[model samples]
Target: TVFLTTHFMDEAQALADRLAIIADGMIVATGSADELIGAGSTNTRIRFRLPETSQLPDTFEARRDISAWELETDTPTRTLHELTEWALGTETELLDLEVTRRSLEDVYLQLTAEAAEP
Candidate 1:
């Protein structure tokens, strides 16, 4: 048996086969990385950069910084497909496109925040 304690979520995720999140001396949640991340969320983050002159779809409320846009949605695959189709149709290149799932650190913060609520 091995026992480890650390405040770093990355370290915990790297070393532990099972994880337990404790807050205020109470074990608030326990699960593997995948389980914990999927426990309370289905949203995926999509980020991309487009030409400054290009227009985004009206349905997408992207938080824009310069030419980069970031948004979260549950249907990432479909969104990616739509973006691809749109790009092809408009003859625009999707620069720096990235898709990211919620990380262990995100899960930890969410669980801790919920545990703190009364």
Candidate 2:
């Protein structure tokens, strides 16, 4: 039963049960954090370190880091399952496995940016 407005995205994400993004005096988007981020544009990144000789399937658009490889995908659940299965099958040790999801701020920026576009 409380209404609050702030330019700080983290504050809104932390305190609000529901969120609405206003751009050009119009409500461009509205939803919970997960809903807005999961809609269509957001991507989850999977990062891991593996033996240099071991390679992932061609479907993964992997980029090599100093010691880790990373890829962004919309279907993280399926990707993780396939990755683990591949690791098990190849006897490859996955190191520093991390999943990074799009944040509320990212969604906010995207929504606002789209609204600004002609």
Candidate 3:
């Protein structure tokens, strides 16, 4: 059995067959990367940008700049489908779109944050 400790979640995910998260001098959680990430409500994250001329829908939580917008969603597949349809309907260009799963680091942070709460 190898006992290792580090603050780097990415390193833990990469090196460990089983991962443990310690917080406040206690073992808060333990699992593999997939297990930990799957336990969360948000399994997927979608990020995207639309053209400056495009109008953002009220359902989307987005941050806008001069020429682009960024947004994240928990349901990537459904959201992507809806977004694509919306883009087609609105005649907007979808730019800089990225879809990713919730990382081990995100799970670690969420667990630690919850542990810190009273």
Candidate 4:
């Protein structure tokens, strides 16, 4: 058995054959990706197509702390709800304002990375 710890969340996700995380060195969560993803939450990616493809307001929902949002939800429905709201709010002159499920890779990248690390 390998007893290990890492500062990189990606590293934690990668080497985590069966992950057990401790926020303050105290066990807080434990599970595989699916288990953790299911048990914890997920984010949604809102992809929008503006009227001119440039008219898309870069601003996100400030009140929701969703200006360019990246937050976790207890269920997939939660993300969908926020996505719908976002789309409706932006559909005034936009086309294809839709929400997509945030992939595991997406979360991994967002949580601890900007670009892929080597």
Model number with the top lDDT:
2
lDDT of 2 at 62: 85
Root-mean-square deviation per candidate: 2.5, 3.3, 2.4, 8.0
lDDT of 2 by residue, 1-118 (tens): 8888999988998999988899999999888877887884637988999887888777776888788888778889998898898899989999889999978887888888999999
Q: Can you give the lDDT of residue 29 in candidate 4?
A: 54
TM-score of each: 0.77, 0.65, 0.83, 0.46
Q: Mind giving the per-residue lDDT tens digits that candidate 1 earns over 20-49?
A: 999878999998888887776655888999
What digit string (tens of lDDT, one per residue) describes model 3 on residues 3-118? 98888888888889998888888889888888888888778776667665668888877667665565556677777898889899988888887778888988888899999999
Clash count for each candidate, listed in order shown: 0, 0, 0, 0
In model 2, the runs with Cα more than 4 Å from the true position are: 1-3, 23-26, 42-44, 63-67, 73-75, 113-118
* Model 4 C-alpha lDDT per residue in residues 1-118, reported as the tens digit of each score: 8977665656776777776655434455566766655543445545444444333334443222222333344454755565556657856443454556555445444433423334
| lDDT (0 to 1) per candidate | 0.85, 0.86, 0.81, 0.50
Better of 1 and 3 by TM-score: 3
Q: lDDT score, residue 101, model 4?
A: 58
Candidate 2's TM-score reads 0.65
TM-score result, candidate 4 = 0.46
The segments of candidate 3 whose C-alpha lies over 4 angstroms from its true place after superposition are 61-74
Best-fitting candidate, scored by TM-score: 3
User: Ten consecutive residues with minimal summed lDDT in candidate 2?
Assistant: 33-42
Flag the better candidate by TM-score, 2 or 3: 3
